[model samples]
Target: MVPVAALAAGAAIILSGCSAGQVSQTADQVAAINGNTAEAGSIALRNVHIVFPGSGTHTNTAGGQAALALSIINTGETVTDELTGVTTDLGTVKITPADGDKIEIAPSETIVVSTPSAGAETHTTGETVDTEAGTTEAAAIEITGLTQDITPGLTYNVSFNFKENGTVQVEVPVDAGIESPRHESELSKSTTGSAGGH
Candidate 1:
């Protein structure tokens, strides 16, 4: 006959191992929320406003260059909180005018950057009259390196530093908000409380 104590001890060891695995899994889930995982209620940018001289434009020798400025605001409560992990799809900044032509403004503040361009002026007769010296294709600036804990009802002012054709330096804004993730369990509790009060 087999000994009962030996079987009981073996069972206890198995249960202990299982419990440890469950705890590890829970920790991993929380870390995913902090950075890796794209769970529901993720962070996103909204209401972005880019302020620069003449609506942000860009031009190249091929006459296909376009200039564009960006003003982005965090929209999602959860995604905003994870700004540190946010990566911009735009590559880099190039061909800035001699005078530093890029600035980032806040909700109530503004900055200016300038670029100059000179092109020919055409007359109604399809003849080149005279080249008007003015700002041609504007420069395009994009923001990168966005990461922070975003809060609700707050705004941040970030700057994008352009390179000749390399990575840009995105300055972190001082007014950014950091918000905590909301737990669904709290809603359940509130519902239960309301039902009991009735």
Candidate 2:
């Protein structure tokens, strides 16, 4: 038997434990899953993953480029929000559609974007500012100037900016040889966004 006060406190701890990494995590888009599911406010981010450069289709410029693939779902029946900007600890972030013209997540609707060329890019001190792995959707954002290494299973933080919900950051997992089926495209085979949009 346990004291009522102690039991109550224990229960609180257990419940809060279930929400780990979610509290005060308004600045880490790199890790977005508690068993492959994460959320902020009324928006749930699912199957969130990041890809690094390797041989073949995944060959990015080492410390050059990376991309994020995930689905955004709005859980609220009447709530709506816009995905504005994206940022990573390794570099700068830019989103397509932008804030004023951002990708809107309607109530209970999931939006998927998979186009690396227009997605996110990680740049090194290369002559050009282009990413090797390019895929983006829902207003892709390119990350320029990478200051860290991108390797498989390596985790980093990316802050996702959203209208009406501010910024929600999560630690994203790096999958070396994995690319979302939807994100894989013929455009990825070519060196696109050399103009600096990669």
Candidate 3:
């Protein structure tokens, strides 16, 4: 069982950059509003957002790569967890972290998966990614062979596979709201990088 205090802290981290009725809402918010559970085993995923290209309002073209942003909090006190990969109906999520490894969270630690360095942004085009490139701490997932079946403001089924716990499935929201400060920071850096490149 997850500690109440730990869950509370996890909730706080998920809500750090969000408010009500906007993209600021975390994955927990989406899950709660959608009547789903964001916690699985000792892993709790929150504040998840998907990007469909062309800012927060436009949708990505078919075959275009999409991005994702979310936070994972390990509530276990003694066990560490590994996020092996992500999968969707479109196919397996192909993201080679600039750092070269799957995400591993220590007990009671939280890791946020966001934009990748140079290759892709959290959920935007290369132009969009250039506006938010600095930290490669987060993993950047590039969805290949994507078609027009997905769109923004809609929900999709995604599975996150862990080394020990197996797969946890959830519906992720394609949010364009810049409510998450960390999420926004990527944009800020992207803007800076874009300007500096000239």
Measured by TM-score, the strongest candidate is 3
Q: Could you tell me every candidate's TM-score relative to the true structure?
A: 0.22, 0.54, 0.56
lDDT for model 1 comes to 0.28
| Each model's lDDT | 0.28, 0.58, 0.60
Structure candidate 3, residue pairs in collision: 18-24, 27-47, 67-123, 130-190, 131-190, 131-191, 132-186, 132-190
Listed per model in order, the count of residue pairs whose N, CA or C atoms clash below 3 Å is 24, 27, 8
Residues 17-51 of candidate 2 have per-residue lDDT tens digits of 76466564564565534214567888887766665
lDDT of 3 by residue, 1-198 (tens): 569989999999878756654554363433333112377788887766665354432234566566666767787888877888888876447765434466776677666566533222343322211213122245556566666556656877888888877788888877544342343565465453454654
State the TM-score for model 1. Answer: 0.22
Which ranking of candidates, highest TM-score first?
Answer: 3, 2, 1
**Of candidates 2 and 1, the better by lDDT:** 2
Stretches of model 1 off by over 4 angstroms after superposition:
21-23, 31-198
Tell me how far the alpha carbon of residue 44 in candidate 1 is from the true structure, in angstroms, after superposition: 16
Q: Model 1, range 68-129, lDDT digits (tens) per residue?
A: 23222222222112112112333223433212443212222111222222111111111122
